[model samples]
Target: MDVQPGPEREDSHVDSDVSASTPLRVALLGAGVVGGAVARHLTERADDMAARVGAPLALVGIAVRRPGRDRSDLGVDPSLVTTDAEQLVTRADLVVEVIGGIEPARSLILRAMEHGASVVTANKALLAEDGPRLYAAAAEHRVDLYYEAAVAGAIPLLRPLRESLAGDEVRKVLGIVNGTTNYVLDKMDTSGAGFEDAVEQAQALGYAEADPTADVEGFDAAAKAAILASLAFHTRVSGSDVHREGITDVTPADVAAAREMDCVVKLLSICERTDAGVSVRVHPAMIPRSHPLAGVRDAFNAVFVEADAAGQLMFYGRGAGGEPTASAVLGDLVAVARHRVGGGLGPGESSYADLPILPMGDAQTRYYVSLDVADRSGVLAKVAAAFAEHNVSIETVRQRMVPDERDGDRHDVGEATGNSNARANLVIVTHAAPDAALSATVESLRTLDVVRGVNSVMRVEGS
Candidate 1:
C-alpha cells in the first residue's frame, strides 16, 4: 500500500498552489442518477474542491456494471468508464460508492478499503445491513469511511448524530425520513384521497416509484430507523430488528378521523432509548397538526433529535433526490480527500456500547383505535372492560351512531328492543401503554360479541 503525504491548509484569500502534493484520485462505483451527479460535480468543480481540500481531487475512473453505455453526456472521459469494478478500486486513493444494494457494492467497498483506500458511500441499505463489518474493515486498514448521504440526503443528519452530538447523549430521534410515503399520506390528508389514489398521485408527480412497496410497506423507513438507532444509541441495529408497519392500510376514514382531532397521519421512523435498551420502529403515526413534524407537508423530510446537552435539534431539507444526494456524496468526498491529505482518518463506527435492541412489544406508545360496534347499550362498557383486562388505560373516547348499510337496513339507536341495525363508530385514544398490551386489547375486542370490526389502529407520535 502506498502512503500519501498530508497537505497543509493555506489562507482562504490566497490563490494557493497545490502542485507539490499528489492528487487524490477518486473512483466512482456507479453512474446512475446519483452517481452521475457525483461524477459531474467532481469533474466540473474540481478546481474549487481542490482548493478547499488544499489538494487536487481527481476523478480517475468510473465503474459501471454495464459496459459501453453512452455516458459521454456526464462529461467524463469515455476511457475512464469501464465495467470492471474490482480492478478500478485497486489504483485509487479514495472510492465513492453510490451503487446501492448488498452484493457487488459491498464486495467492491471492502476490497477498496483492503487495498489502502478511503471510502465514501451513499449506500443506505448496505450500511443498515452490514455496517459493522465495513466499519471494522476500515478500522483495521486505518482508512476513513464516511457516508453522509446514506440517510436524509442533503439534510446533514447522520453527521450531527455521529460527530456533532458525540459529546451529548441523544435520548430520542423521530423523523419523517421517507418522502414517498410522506407525500402519499399528505395527499390523503389534504385531498381526502384513498390510499391507492394518493399513491397514484405520488407516482404521477414523481414522488413515488412504479413499485412503491419498499417505501409504502415501511421497509425504507425501517432501514433508516435501523441506521439512526445504531448511531444514536451506540448500538448495532439491523433493518430486521426494526418493527415496521406501512401506510397502505391508512384509509380516507382514518384521514378524516385525524382531521377531526387537528392531526395528520405520517409514516414516522422513531428511535429511542429505553430502560431495557434501545427501541426502533417505523409506522404510520398521528401527529398533532400544530407540531413541527405535522406541518412538514409534501415530500420534504425533517428529523427531531432530543439530546441531554443540546436539548432539541431539528434537521430539515429535501430528503431524497439526485442533486441533493450528490451534494452529500461530494461533501463526504471532500472530507475524505482532506483526511488523506492531512494523514488522519475521520470518525469510524462507535458501537463500543453495543446496547441491546429492545423488543417492539415492550415499546411504550399511545394508540388511536377506531372500532365498529353494535349500537346497543353496554357496548362501551364492554370495550372498556376489555382494555382493563389488558391493563391499558383510555385517555379519551368519542362515539357516533351510523345507520347500518348492510342490506339497506335502517337501524336506530332509539328503537329500544326493536329490530334496529344501528352501529356505533367508537374512536378511542389511549394513554401510553406497552405495545403488547395494546395489541392484545385489540385482539380481545375482536372476540367480543358486540364488536363488529377493528376499523383502524395507529400509533400516536409527537406531542
Candidate 2:
C-alpha cells in the first residue's frame, strides 16, 4: 500500500543505535479490518519502523471482544489477544484505536492518555462529536492525540491542513467525502439507473451496506464535513451544525436533467468561509463535467481546497476500503510513534478562530428546478411570477412539450398555446440566491394551479 508520511521534522532526534533506545510498546484496540491490517503491517515492517523511529516497535497486545475468534489469518499471536481492553491500554506507550463509536473507545482513549500513552484513532463520528474534550485530556496529560485516518481515508489531508497550510488562509473545502453515495451517483450518471437500482448495484458490489442509512441519509458525509470545517476554519463545528440533504430523494428525472445542462449529480460535503461566519453543508448538487470533482467516480474520493496563498489544490485517491483506511491508520501510528520516541507531542487541536457556523437559510447558491406544468400560455407567466415573488432571479427558462407517450400520466388543463393538449416540461435555472428564498420559490410553485408537480430541485455548484 502507498502510504504518504506526514510533514518532515525539524528536530534531529534520529538515533541509529539499535540497543540504546527503549522499544515502544504498542497496544491495538479492535481486531477488525483496520486494526488487523495495522497489526499485520506492523509485524511485516517491524525492522523498517524500528530503524526509522530509532526504537523497536513491539505489538504488546491486541484488545478484542472475541479473543477466541481465530485471527491467525492476520498473523497475530494468540497470546497477545485479551478481553480486558482497559488493562491492555495501560501497558502500552502508544495506542492505536480503530474501534468506532462513542462510548468505550472514547473512555479508553482518555484513560490511555492519562496513563502517558499517545493515541492515534480513525473514529470520525466520535471526533466530530467530542473532539474538544479529548484534545484537552491529551493536552493535560502531555500526550499526543493524532487522528489522520478520521477523514479522507489515506489521502493525508488533516496533516497538510494542520501543518503545511498553517500559514495560508484556507478559503474553501469541497469534497465527495462518502464513497457509497459516490458509487450510487456514478451508477445513476453512467447507467441511467434510478436511486433504488443504483443503490442495489452498490450493495451487490459491496460498496454499500444492507442498512445504508448513514451513507444514503448524508449522516456520514455530514460528520466528515464537521471535521473538515473545524480544521479549515479553526472552529469547533459539530455534525449537527451542518445542513444535510441525502440522495434518497434523487430521482431519475434529476439525473436526466443534469445531462441536459452538461452536469452530473454528486453528493458533496462543502465547507467555506462566508462573511457572516463559516458555512458547512452536505447535499446532492450538480457540477459541470469540466469541474475536477465531476470526474471523481465510483468509490473514489477527492477534495478541492482553495487557500489564499497557495491558490487551488486537489487531493485525489481511493478514499475507503480496509486497506486504504488502514494505510491512514498506519501513517498516524508511525507519526505518533516517532513523537513518543522523541518524548514530544504532535500537533494538538487548533480551534483558536472559534468561528460561528452560519445557518443554511443564509447560504447562497444557484438552483436548477424542473416542473411539470399544463402546456398553456398564462401558466408560464404564473410560474415566472412565483420566482419573482420569492425574490429569486432566474438566469434562463426553457419550456418544451413532453412526448405523447411520456405525457400520458400528465393531465392537460386546457388549450392555450400552439401545442394544445400536451403537458410541458419547464426548466428554470436560477442565479445565486439565498437558500431560504429558493426553497420558498419551490414551495410557492407547488401551490400554483398550473404546476402539476415539482419534478426535481437541485443546487448548482462549481464553475
Candidate 3:
C-alpha cells in the first residue's frame, strides 16, 4: 500500500539550514508491534524521508524489555536492540514511543524531551492521564511532542483537531474508537451471535485480547475519548472523567431490535461541548443504520466531528495492528524530523480552555430500553406511565408476544425460544432526556410486579 503523507506535510517547511554531514539519529522505545513497524518504516522510506527533511535519518538504537528477542519482521539489525532504555533516549535527536500505558513510557519520553530531542508517541492512556505534564515538559524543553497514533491508529484525527480545524470551533467529537468492541458488536448484529459468542469469535480472530475486559468494558475507548475530548475542547480530561458503558450487556435480541428500528448497535465514544461544560463518554449506542459511523464494521474505526466551519467531518480507517499504527507514528516522525532539521517546532501547549467535565447525569441523549414483562393487560400502559412520570418522551415502542412451546407452533420458533415463553419483550426508544430521569424511570419500571426484567438499556445516537 502507498503511504500517504499527513496534514503536516502540506505545510511550508522550516528555514533552518543544517549541515549535510549530520545524520538525524532516532531512538525507538518498545520493540513491540508498533515499534517494530516504525523501525521498518524508517528503513523502507529512508531515501524519501531523508530527501524531504534534507538529511538522512538513522535508527541509532531501540529499547526493548528483552534485548535478545528476534525482530526479523522489522528488517533491521538485531544488534541495535538494547535493554537500557535510559541510555537510548540520550543518544538520539528524536525519539518515538509506542510503549503503551503509563509509567516508563511517560518517564522515558520526558527524559528524551529534557535531552533536547523531539518525541512522538502512540500512547493514548499516558496522554489522557498525564497530557498536561508531558505537554509542560515538552514546552519546558522547547521540543515537539506529537501523538497522532494515540487515538485512532491510522486515522489523522489529532492533526486535524490541532491544525486543520484550528480556527474552527469543534463542538463535538463522537466516534467508534475501539475496533475490538466494534468488531464484536458488528458480528453480533450481522451473524446473530450473542455477546459472549461474538467476543469469543473476536478473540479467535485476533481482534480482541485474551483478557478483553479493557475493550469490552469501555476502558480503552474511554481512554481514547478522554484524549480526543482534551484535544477537541482544549481541556484536561482524564480517563476517570469519561462515563463508560460496555458492550458486554448487549444481546442478540437488542441487535435484532436495532435492525427492526432501522439502526445498528455500536460502541460509541462521545465528546460534546454543552452549555454546562464538556461531556465525554463511551457507551454502546444505537445509531441509525444510514449514519456514517454505523457503516464502520469489523475491526475498523471512525471518528465523526462537528465543527462550526467544517460542519461534519468523518475520519475512518484501521484503528489497530502494527503496520497501520506505524504509519501514523512515522508520519509524526517525518514532521518532527522536518521541524528539527529546520530549527523549529510544532504548536505548543493547548490546555488554554479549561472546560469542566460534566457528570453523566447532566449529559443528555436519547435511550433505547428493552424490558421483559408478563403477557397481561395494562403492562404497556404502566410502563409508559413510568416514562411519563420522569418526563421521558417516547419515540417508538415495540411489543411482541412470546408463545409457550406447549401451546402450539409459534409464528417464529427461532425468535420466541430465545426469551422466556411466559414473558413478552417490550422495546422502547425514548427522546433526549436527562440521564438521572432515565435511570429513575427504569427504576420505577423495575418496581412493577408485572415487569420480569430490564433486558437492556442502551443510548441512541445519530438519530
Against the true structure, whose TM-score is highest?
1
Candidate 2: deviation at residue 15, Å?
17
| lDDT tens digits, residue span 294-350, model 3 | 899999999999998889999999999998999999999989988887788899668
Candidate 1, 1-463: lDDT as tens digits: 1112223223211121224256777888999999999888877777788789888776778899887678876786787888889977877778999989899989999998877888999888898899899999999988888888988889999988999999989999999999999999998988888899889998998889899999999988998889999989899999999999998888898889889988999999999997689989998989999888998888899999999999999999998988999999999988887777777778989987788888889999999999888877788789999999999999999876675655545444333544345677889999999999999999999999889899989899887
Task: Give the winner by TM-score: 1 or 2.
Answer: 1
TM-score of each: 0.93, 0.92, 0.91
Of candidates 3 and 1, the better by lDDT: 1
Clashes of each: 3, 0, 0
Q: Candidate 1 regions off by >4 Å?
A: 1-20, 404-417
Q: After superposition, how far is residue 279 of candidate 1 from its true place, in Å?
A: 0.5
lDDT of 1: 0.86
Candidate 2 lDDT over residue span 1-463, tens digit each: 2112222223322221224256777889998988988888888787888787777777888899897788987675687888899977776777899989998999999988877788999999999889999999989888889888888898989899988999999999999999999999999999988899989998998889899999999999999999999888889999899999999998887888898899999999999997789999999999999999999999999999999999999988888778898899888887877777665777888999988788998888899998988776688779889999989999998865575444454433344434544677889999999899999999999999888888889999997
